[model samples]
Target: MWGEMLGAAIGGVVAVAAAPVVLSAVGFTGSGIAAASIAAKMMSAAAVANGGGVAAGSLVATLQSIGVLGLSTSTNIILGSVGAAIGAAGASEVS
Candidate 1:
């Protein structure tokens, strides 16, 4: 768990740092997919925190077990895209 989070943090740091320069290039679709991936990761991590483990395919198992983050597809799409765009922009200014 620690390892995974640390890795994410490092990757996120770099991604956030470089994301802005590419946001315009990433465009709507790319940002949307990125957001969805983040949502999935967050939900999976939550599951792991509640009971899941640090085993291989644990996140997949968690997602399969819970059946979506209780959010509708449309909502996910809008939220993810918007969130990703804003997050990337904000992150770029951090460092």
Candidate 2:
């Protein structure tokens, strides 16, 4: 249980941290690019987290027992995207 939580948290943090770099790699730049990058990173993180959960032997049970995590993942994606968009806009403004 604790392991799953830890893994998810780590994954989320990693995704957030890596968003900018990943976006930049994909040719994302300027103000709004940051938001897009963050979104992409979050989506990547969720996919990774889901894979990890399956590997940890809790995928099915986790889904059955607690569905909120899935919702949280969706929320994370949306929020991340918004953030990236904002960043891109900011970057454009600066440029």
Candidate 3:
């Protein structure tokens, strides 16, 4: 529905807007490193989630250890949710 589209748009905007702030706050100067780390962590979480275990905590820990100090608990949940939604949509489209 239109509401979902609006929500997704807002979420995308928030994620885009927050990315730089997060990277700078976490002391990551390289986009490549940030992108790689995030992708790896998200993939790890996906694996864990598929195995019937929640990986959000592990993902958060990994991000925190990598200096993502500005990434709050809510941010982790939002990011994870977004990642999951994207994956599901892609899978459905491919199927």
Candidate 4:
């Protein structure tokens, strides 16, 4: 019970503290992600305009081509797991 809380606290702190160093070492940045997403959206818009077809599938495929869809899915999964962990830790304390 308490152990889980301690584990969550320590793990959260360590992950937060290490994330910047890890991200920087790997040359990942929020700005880069945002720029890529904007580029992908623009590309999708251009493709739709050129194709003269407003099919949603075409836009999805265009975004997927730029890895936008895949990255977003993976990010959601990772964040969901972290949220679940944090939520569980809190629940344990209440119970």
Candidate 1 TM-score, C-alpha based: 0.26
Per-residue CA lDDT of model 1 for 1-95, tens digit only, reads 44444444555555444433343233222223234454456545766686864344654443333242333556445545555555555555563
Query: Cα miss at 28, model 4 (Å)?
Result: 3.9
**Per-residue lDDT tens digits of candidate 4, residues 11-54?**
55554445444443333334332334554455457666878534
Candidate 4 worst ten-residue window by lDDT: 62-71
What TM-score does prediction 4 earn? 0.32
Give the better candidate number (2 or 4) by lDDT.
4
- Which clashing pairs does model 4 show? none
1-95 in candidate 2: lDDT tens per residue? 44444444555555555654554554344332234554345444556778742333443333322222223556557645655555555545555
Q: What's every prediction's RMSD, in angstroms? A: 15.0, 17.2, 13.7, 10.1
The Cα local distance difference test for each model comes to 0.46, 0.47, 0.55, 0.50
For candidate 3, which ten residues in a row score worst on lDDT? 26-35
Which model, 2 or 4, shows the larger TM-score?
4
Residue-by-residue lDDT tens digits, candidate 3, 16-82: 4666567655444333334446545555566677694436566544554444344566776677568
Q: Any runs in candidate 2 off by more than 4 Å, and if so which?
A: 31-95
TM-scores, all candidates, are 0.26, 0.32, 0.32, 0.32
- lDDT (C-alpha) at residue 20 in model 4: 45
